[model samples]
Target: MENPIINVKNVSFRYERENVLENIDLSIPKGSFLGLVGPNGSGKSTLLKLILGLLKPQKGRIELFGMPISKFREWDRIGFVSQKANSFNTGFPATVYEVVASGLTKKIGLFHFMDKKMKEDVISAIHSVGMDPFIHRNIGELSGGQQQRVFIARAIVSKPEILILDEPTVGVDVKNVQAFYEMLDKLNKQLGITLILVTHDIGTVTNKVTHVACLNKFLHFHGDKEEYEKLEEKDLSSFYQFDVKVLSHEHN
Candidate 1:
């Protein structure tokens, strides 16, 4: 891309005796919905952590908006959505509005009441995710798919320019997966948010994401969807056995 929003150059990371990522170079252009796919333990989460500034790479450099990650202090410009089911308590006693409103904690600071404008932003975010009807409903009472959208609203309520989602659909129903992705497409196309999605739903994402990056410790491929789609299906099925995670989740 001419001027990427996020850039990684020759980045290598490891844990204890194992190397997770090696000499990886990747860039995310503004307004691009890039899907990051690879096998489990191929450092997908590690790479995300590096980009989120949760962990630093042992070698090479990473930049956010052309600024070195170490010096890039505009964290509010980015939003992150993690696999919620693993951590969120289904019985948490909070309404959807209350849950989404909490996203402003860092931006609005602690113990301060939200201004009317902030409340409007929260409601608008919920509307954008098509969850405004359930604004006052209990979070735990909602289905997995509904909860997922609420969390996304929470992430975008702050009006972040970039959204990074790591397996955000793990608990969603099979039937609702496409709808989830459609909402993501809306966020990218309508809201103009840059998205870096680490996903295994290649069969669906290929139709939505602008770019695709195949990772297996080493980046096997990084290109536009059309270029990736042009590869023979048989070739992918045969050559990418090393990355079973991608092949296993190609469900349409």
Candidate 2:
């Protein structure tokens, strides 16, 4: 078996006196599409933050690409799309090309003009997300789904090995959500980018992801989709700390 791209061992965290996560262990291998499902306030987002090095765990360790997060400095190796990215100011004045090109600002440094290769990379990223047609459009003028795709292009502009998303389809219309997921699937399979998605749409994500991790201040379940699908309602309910049902649905 290949080594894990992301590893969390005996991780625990808290906010003041409240314990948010306790003794969490998870391993995500290369090319794995992992879905993180849990109820609200279940510490799903917190765990993502921990893995992203945005927050420090009170106890235990986390590794990204086999390097300890605390010592890891190669941030360009990972891409992140937050839940609030699609909610950018409607009047923000930036073109899609400009937005996607911003992903290289850190590497390019201040006041440095985009060279020919950088411009090609920008266009390539937009094409990867199927937003080439809107490459020149104003980012603020696009629909929520379109804007989300542009942000995804921005995230992948650097060609990161791992992509972490938190509730990426929140503001997107139902009609476009499936397409958004399809694009993500393409990125994972064709591009070979590892995916870690934190979402509440278990019914929808279960069909798309290769692995599932159930979280609620603790690691309740961690396994492949087949085993997750075989779980009983009672087991799921216990994991979520409430009554829940796993519905069967077909993916488009």
Q: Over the full model, what C-alpha lDDT does candidate 2 score relative to the true structure?
A: 0.90
lDDT of 2 at 1: 39
| Cα lDDT tens digits for candidate 1, 46-78 | 999999999999999999999999999999999
Off by over 4 Å in 2: 248-252
Can you write out model 2's per-residue Cα lDDT over 135-228, one digit (the tens) per residue? Answer: 8899988988888888889999989999999899988998877788889999999999999998888777777799999999999999999999
Q: What is the lDDT of residue 194 in candidate 1?
A: 99
Lowest summed-lDDT stretch of 10 residues in model 1? Answer: 242-251
- CA-only RMSD, every prediction: 2.4, 1.3
Q: Give Cα-based local distance difference scores for all models.
A: 0.88, 0.90
Clashes of each: 0, 0
Candidate 1 — which residues are off by over 4 angstroms?
242-252
lDDT for 174 in candidate 1 is: 86
Pairs that collide, model 2: none
